[model samples]
Structures are given as C-alpha cells and as structure tokens.
Target: TNTTKELTYSEAMYLCGYLNGAKKENRDLTITEREIRRRRSAVLKRVQRIGIDTTDWGAVNAFFLDVRIAGKKFRELDGEELLLLIPKLESILKKKEDGGY
Candidate 1:
C-alpha cells in the first residue's frame, strides 16, 4: 500500500515543457495558466463527487490528478500504479469522510 509510483521531478519538468510548447505552437489559439488551473479544479471536483465508496474511483481520481498536473502528455504513466494506490487512497478518504485523522 505504500509503494505508489509518482512521477520523478525530471519527468514532471519534461511534461511541463511539452505542455508549454504545445500551447505556443497553436496558431489560432490562446491559453492561460488560469485556464489550466480552472480545468484542474473541475477535474478534482468531479473525482470527489464519485462518493469515495469505491476503490476504483479513488484510484482513477489520483491518476487523474497526476494527469492534470503533468500536462496530459505523460507517456510514462502505465495506469498500473492506480491499482497499487487505490487501497491507500480509500483509507485516507474514509478517514477524511469520518472526521478522523
């Protein structure tokens, strides 16, 4: 339950660079950091709305959070980490739900 794989700092930097490039390469498009953050917030809210009862939902949401921050071109993510992390997230969510630490 403790072996959740997270993106390394280098990987995260690479992803952010790619995202910046993508935004700049758009000829007829404009994007802002505010827009990205707003989208990320929306995704976070949707994940919470899944009710925290199912392991799968928690796993999906955690992965989704990584995706949001990593700028969506994360080729290294294999989705298997979600299978490993769901139980831990479930417990955390349960504690948060029940007013426990």
Candidate 2:
C-alpha cells in the first residue's frame, strides 16, 4: 500500500523549517571544521591510548592556559582553535611520557 497523505499548512511550514535549519547547519561547517574535527579526534584517541589523564581538570586547564587557548574546555574550541590545540596536546603528552607532568 502506497497511499500518500498531504501535509497541512502548519505541518508543511514545520517541515520546511526543519529542512532549512538542517541545510543551514550543514552549510555552516566549512572544510576547516571537518579538518579540525578529524585532527582533534585523532589527537584525542592518541592521548587516550597513551593514558593521559584528560579527566584531570588541573592538568587540562594548565595545558590550555599555557597554550593560550581562550577556553578551558576542549569541546568549546572551534576548528582553528583545535588546530592550534592538537600540537600542544601532543607536546604535553610527550612531556608526560618523559616524566614531566
């Protein structure tokens, strides 16, 4: 059975708004965002595998503060900010491995 039901005016408007919002959201993310997310994910995975204590607020805050990242929270960082953060995170991880934490 392939019966079709036409949408009401309000339903149509709601659908349109939902679709437009989705499109706008996708359009808002440029290539830089994608790249930054990719890099950030990789860095986080590596850090986790290396057993860095990401849950340690003091350490994480110190790292972000030292690197001059405006936000103390990693999830709040934007794409360009993540780009700057990844290398600093790696360096911090390296220092930790070398008993510098």
Candidate 3:
C-alpha cells in the first residue's frame, strides 16, 4: 500500500533553517530536494563518463557530501548549502569539459 504524510508549517520553516545553513531535523523531501537530485544527476553523469559506477550510492553520496559542507547524505542539504554547492558542481563540469575529470 502507498501512503503519504503532509508537512506542517513548522516543519516547512524548519526546512527553511536546515536548507539555509542552520541545523534542524529533515522532516521530509521538498522542492529543494528535487533540485539537489537534478544537480546530483548532472555530476554523476560526468562521473560515469570518467568510468565510475553510478549505481554505487556510497560513492555518489560521498561525492555530494564532500561538495557541500554539511549533511551526512546529499538529500539533507538545504537551500543555503545548495547555493554553495551549485558553483562547485558547475566548476567541476567546466574543468571536466577541458578533460580534467
């Protein structure tokens, strides 16, 4: 069976802090998570081209965790962290385009 739980406003606010560089509980996935997922995919596609197995979540999470300053898992990164991470990811892509990856 499939079920879902809705978020409370307080939880949304907490996600605000959590995403904006403050520590807080990650109650659920939100729009920012989707954006993070997209960014991760872009990186991993390049990673795969460099011959790393994208199927291994361990390596994937490690790469993302290293990209941002926080979050044990990539999914836990919030908006502020995302802002920091985007440039880094783009830079990596740019360098790789020049055959550095």
Q: Rank the candidates by lDDT, best first.
A: 2, 3, 1
The 10-residue segment of model 3 with minimum total lDDT is 23-32
Which one is best on TM-score? Answer: 2
Report the alpha-carbon TM-score of model 3 versus the true structure: 0.42
Per-residue CA lDDT of model 2 for 1-101, tens digit only, reads 23225777776776776877745555566555678779778756655655656777566546455545445566666677766766776786788889996
Q: Which prediction has more favorable TM-score, 2 or 3? A: 2
lDDT of each residue in 5-93, candidate 1, tens digit only = 47677767766767778444452344444444454444444445534322465455455456433323222333443233345445656
Candidate 2 clash pair list: none
lDDT of each: 0.47, 0.64, 0.62
Model 1 compared with the native: what TM-score? 0.27
Model 3 pairs in collision: 19-78, 19-79
Residue 34 CA error for candidate 1 (Å)? Answer: 31
- Candidate number with greatest lDDT: 2
CA displacement after TM-score superposition, residue 9 of candidate 2 (Å): 37
Give per-candidate clash totals: 0, 0, 2
